[model samples]
Target: MSHSPVHPQLRLYFENPVGRLLEHPDGYLVVQYNAGKRKLEELKTFLTQASTLLQQRNWHKLLGDQRVMAAFTEAERVWITENWLTRSTTAHPYYGAVLLAHDVFARLAMNLVMNEARESGLVYRLFEDENAAVAWLLQVP
Candidate 1:
């Protein structure tokens, strides 16, 4: 991934080819995905790193910027729902605000995963704008 800096307020935590994990000054996590097809292992590694950071920080809020992301494979979606989301929520009262991509297929795939995440006790919302997503996350305790 390019070493370009992210938002001034976000501290870069971890990054790989698939995505970058960042920490907000307001005690939230940020995950911004790259635009490309990725392997399941890559996705898992990326999310696992984010989960580790969340556990370490005891942070419950996540801002997922998926604006340029491609569609997730069925297996990838299942893993997110069944493995990552479930485990992550066990550590805190997790809340996520995701900025949806313009790609309809990506949005549909994420909707499926997030539906399961919600059932697993995650409070989350989808957004079209980053500022709106961050604003909402800041309001959640």
Candidate 2:
């Protein structure tokens, strides 16, 4: 894994199971997952780390870029919905962006997940471009 300090407070890490955590200026956290397929255990570990970051930072915004996640197992899907999505709803992150670039399957799944998240009182937006995602996140005061 290679990490580069994008900003004084923001660090970007890159790896085969690529993921980057951005400590946003407004106390929100952005996690961009570019990891390919992985086992349930791996997914759990990833989500656990993300959960910890969110809790520690008291993040009110989440940006998940699943552009490279080709597919997810049933368990992985369940974990996301039960843990990350559900928790984000209760946490009431100012805004959550799920970015999907190429994977149609993941995009579809995220759409459903976003809908469920909205029902839970969390605001979510789906986008295919990074610029748009960031713009939306920044606009939400």
Best by TM-score: 1
TM-score of predicted structure 2: 0.77
lDDT of 1: 0.87
Query: In model 2, what are the clashing residue pairs, if there are any?
Result: 60-93
Write down the TM-score of every candidate.
0.93, 0.77
Stretches of candidate 1 exceeding 4 Å from the true structure = 1-5
CA displacement after TM-score superposition, residue 36 of candidate 2 (Å): 2.1
Candidate 1 has a TM-score of 0.93
Per-residue lDDT of model 2, residues 34-135, tens digit only: 546676776677667777777776667777767776666667777777877766655454477777747778777777766677666678888877789878
| For model 1, the run of ten residues with the poorest summed lDDT | 1-10
Q: Which stretches of candidate 2 lie over 4 Å from their true place?
A: 1-9, 12-18
Clashing pairs in 1: none
What do the candidate models score in CA lDDT, each in turn?
0.87, 0.67
Choose the strongest candidate by lDDT: 1
